[model samples]
Target: MLQQSARDFLNRQAPVKHLRSLRDAGGSKGFSREVWAEMSALGWPAMAIPEEYDGLGFGFTGMGIVLQETGRTLTPCPLLSSAMMAAAAIVHAGDDAQKSTLLPGIASGEALVTLAFDEHTHHRPGQVAATAKRTAGGFCISGHKRFVLDGAMSDQLIVSARTDDRVPDGRGISLFIVPATASGITITPCQVLDTHVLADITLDDVRLPAAALLGAENEGLAILEYALDAGRIGQSAELLGVALEAFERSIAYLKERKQFGVPIGSFQALQHRAAVLFGELELCKSLVLNALHRLDSDANEIAATASMTKAKVVETASKATAEAIQWHGGIGMTDDFDIGFFYKRARILETMLGDRYFHLDRFARQHGY
Candidate 1:
């Protein structure tokens, strides 16, 4: 299913020319509405949601398969935001009312959503700069959230903020759902290494009613924990896409590009590196699939497995992309080619949820090491 989707997309939207066109607009950061339409038409948004809610109702494994193809093409759509981050949050933490209202729209692609939880403080939702102070009607939000994925384009924004400062940090956080066009909200686009659009969102006395609060007030971090596991899995899934692509490119170059009458691929040292990269990719893939299966089955080891998968996928994929570029020589550096794009995208995807080091520590702690 994954390869077929990728093959179809390759023939249609992900050809070298199509990717180049997105690159020409700007490298790395792009959100193409037309391309988004193609993805929507393909029913990707519905894959992980329940069929009763008008979704495909498949598990993360199915979504991973589709997203592998998405990563292969590197289409500038909001897979993490629309399909995983925001969607999974709804699925895992939302109430029946919230599900009935939000899930259908999300699955159908009429609404685009993204989560904004980062406040520049390291690893604590309790470190929220944004605060929701109680008002007569409901709650008012104030402060900035940086590096929100696809912030400018998403139809709805799910925000995490502190409701109290006296408690331990993550304990006082709360999640809220607000509209993009809501009064007192500003989404400013930030230029970063990847051409992927990121936003600095400022909510100046943005009022959200009682119903806007997701789960319970001042207990959002627990809900965030659920999102984090799913988010890490999603990120791993994305890296798996880059790893496969990088390996394929390395192989192709070795077979064709010549050195002294023989293909450079014939070089012993180069062949060894390709073998290592392929092995790393396979090992990384095993962990992610294990994590995904554990989560879908509600297994006891899901959390620890997620940390394991996150560390391996990010680390191995970084090495994979770098090797692909180095072996391809200078052509990999050019904007006209996909290797550099894959490299940059791999780097961007690597740091999203938890870096390898972060997961390494978490994995050890969870295992009582």
Candidate 2:
């Protein structure tokens, strides 16, 4: 029922044409507030949140279902940034008081939050250079972050900064909840190829109260990694949806398009390509499901599972979208066709969180390879 409802709602309210409209309007918001509000009413943002925090406590599997639907239609929203990623961070590390204060708003969709961990051109969660020096009253953070998802629009940011003067690795890291409007913080919007908005943020001695610190100081690397794994799994679910939709569209097109007075799908070469993609997508479905299940169960091997799922899903989605465009021929390359949108979205998602290479390396390290 959850999957069906999500699919129905997304198809009706936010089809591929919705993305086209948003891109054509050049909206800096990148997503619709009204549509997001509707989703909020339906408890999408609350899927994985616990019931104690005014949420449904549906868990990651339920959340993945909604994400998959959103990906199928290319819907733009903060479900990943605020609801899944930041929420996971808070749940994993935040004190009870912090959870009580933050989770309710996130559950209600009244507040938007995003994680800011990447400081370089690539997605390196542990190589943070941001510094949060202790002050008389609180802490003063100074650093620059790139590719912050929903950074400009979020109400609060879970900023990761180094607390000790150690090397720029996983240790000495801490997470802080910084207000988006905090003084000395600058956010500049950057538009990517997929018509999505990411922010380049600069913090020049941004001051925060002692209460703003999330989790124990200098012990945030674990929290950060936990949140990132959740985000990667959620992204894998979305990528799966993107690939499935693209594959379905391509198959439908192949049947309709004719070559030599017969359906192009009847050609053996095209059939072979479609068959290969179908099998790959099926395998991805199982991987995504397994990852989501592990997260919900708090399995011991979550790190490895998350990395493996992300790596496989990223690769599969890339192939599915590329083949989608190829099968559609010239029309797929044109901006006027919706198929091109899936290809662009796949490219962006491929690099987000951890790319194929990043996940492959992480998965190997996790397994002591």
Candidate 3:
């Protein structure tokens, strides 16, 4: 009931026009400090932090609600990258001192944080090539990270780097919290299909203090996996919302659109299609909710649940958005129509954190075939 109330409230706050206005005003950057401030005032960015850290402590469930609502309207914001993924990395791995220094700023919305993990075109966290060599006083990180969400606008970045070459895959990786404006760091902005901005970052011998290490030396892979599980759940919720919105729009279009002197919804074929999409949307929601509950619980199947949820959401949302476009006819293909935006976002989210095929493979491996 609490989740429902929060979802309804956010829906009211982020209607279609508000989202469209934000998209029009904010282009490549695609974020509004003023809007973020208002959200901060509402305590959104801090929703998952523990209450002891001056946050609302609503956990992933609360974050999921906010993301779902944002996805419904395609609201231009950094809530996913800053609040969900980056905050997860900190909460999971940051030491007490590091948490004390970072969590407060993140919870209060004074600092926007994002993860810089992917070094190549792929989404494999275990394939890290960025190296961070230890120095007398600190570490010098040198390498490139691609597809860093909101990297250009984020105030702090939690970067993953290889600290030991011997352990190759993931055992050698470490995470560091570095200021986005740190010396030797350069960010180049790139645009995604939904007009969201991602960054390709270059770290040319970027130096940081010894205190910058997020977790124990060479122990970041576990933290990254933990963060990815939570991130996948949060993303699935957003995709669920996107599909829900598209399905609703398709239903309304069916009712209003006319063919053969009757509302198109009266047609048996369209009705069946809507029904099938509705079922898929509800199933997606169930998977997301179940995954969220697993993460928040003592369940040992969190990884598998998360993979299942992510895979189902990727498939369901993409199909729902495609059906929405088909049901809406030619107008859906135009930029003026809102359905196209949802479709585009679905396409992008389908790949982030691994696609349907990737998650399916992970899920299978988690279950031992």
Candidate 4:
């Protein structure tokens, strides 16, 4: 199966043990060139690209399968930002020149990129803080983008800014693929609770050529929605992997672990809890697979399925991870234990696309009353 191949590929390249090293180096904790190169060489950074572009061209399901393995190992790479999000945008809306310039760089793993969607201090993609003024050169962008994932590390940035402030919300926002090396751009690292440091970017009259504008001017929020929908599903796949891994770990512990001269797996209470976690994992798995399948066919329903998958996967991962820790006892909490790593990875993935509560509300909204 595709999942098996993906898992085998990761194991052969960077096993679960390497994940601990990455955690020590870049598993939501640090950044390392060693780990990044290893991942890039494995074709993970271009898993979703078309074969004509030198990518695997396996579609969302294949990409999702690879992401699940990445989540299971917690290997550090720009798989999500560069491959899933930025590449998706270029594939969908970039002109021929843009694709020739950016896609090949992405395919070869020579560049890193991330899209900045939210600029609001609150929760809204439409309310962007960044503004772009039309310049003789092209456009001059001025404003700050907060909480951009990998903003500091990206060689190129895909920014959302207002070209028409009077139009309001989604209508005015636009996307710019600005080189990080460009003058007048500043990135300050902001440490997050998850141990990773996201960048807060300041674009101070950052000038760009007209070619920098992706698609049409004053029409970015629509593309942002498309890009976000794609990213959310892949995130859900990773989330599902962690939940399943943790659930399976808990089950294994219950089977082998003994208490009062009997295997804990035989206990009624533990059995019930294990069954519940199994049901949760299976539910998330179904939803994620369903979402992946719809990505190539039904663009209209993608948002709802993506939200639903994210919600279900996040909840399953949280409950499963906690239960794995508890079931494994004190040893599980120790750094020497493997279950602890899985638990930590699961917790991190739960917050990838959005929080559990955020997705739950989104799922509800998308499905109507």
- The clash number for model 2 is 0
What digit string (tens of lDDT, one per residue) describes model 4 on residues 69-99?
7777655567777888898888888998888
- Cα error, residue 64 of model 4, in Å, equals 0.5
Q: Which ten residues in a row have the lowest lDDT in candidate 4?
A: 22-31
Tell me the tens digit of each residue's lDDT in model 3 across 111-131: 889989987777898888889
Question: Candidate 4 regions off by >4 Å?
Answer: 25-31, 120-123, 191-195
> Which 10 residues in a row give candidate 1 its minimum summed lDDT?
120-129
In order, what lDDT does every prediction score?
0.80, 0.92, 0.85, 0.79
Cα RMSD, model 1: 2.0
Candidate 1 C-alpha lDDT tens digits along 288-357: 7777777677833567888888889988989988989899998888876778878887877777666788
Candidate 1 segments exceeding 4 Å error: 26-29, 121-126, 299-301
Q: Candidate 2: worst 10 consecutive residues by lDDT?
A: 164-173
Clashing pairs in 2: none
- RMSD to native for every prediction? 2.0, 1.0, 1.7, 2.3
TM-score list, all predictions: 0.94, 0.98, 0.95, 0.92
| Cα error, candidate 2, residue 327 (Å) | 0.4
Q: 2 or 4, which is superior by TM-score?
A: 2
Number of clashing residue pairs in every model? 5, 0, 0, 1
Q: State model 2's lDDT.
A: 0.92
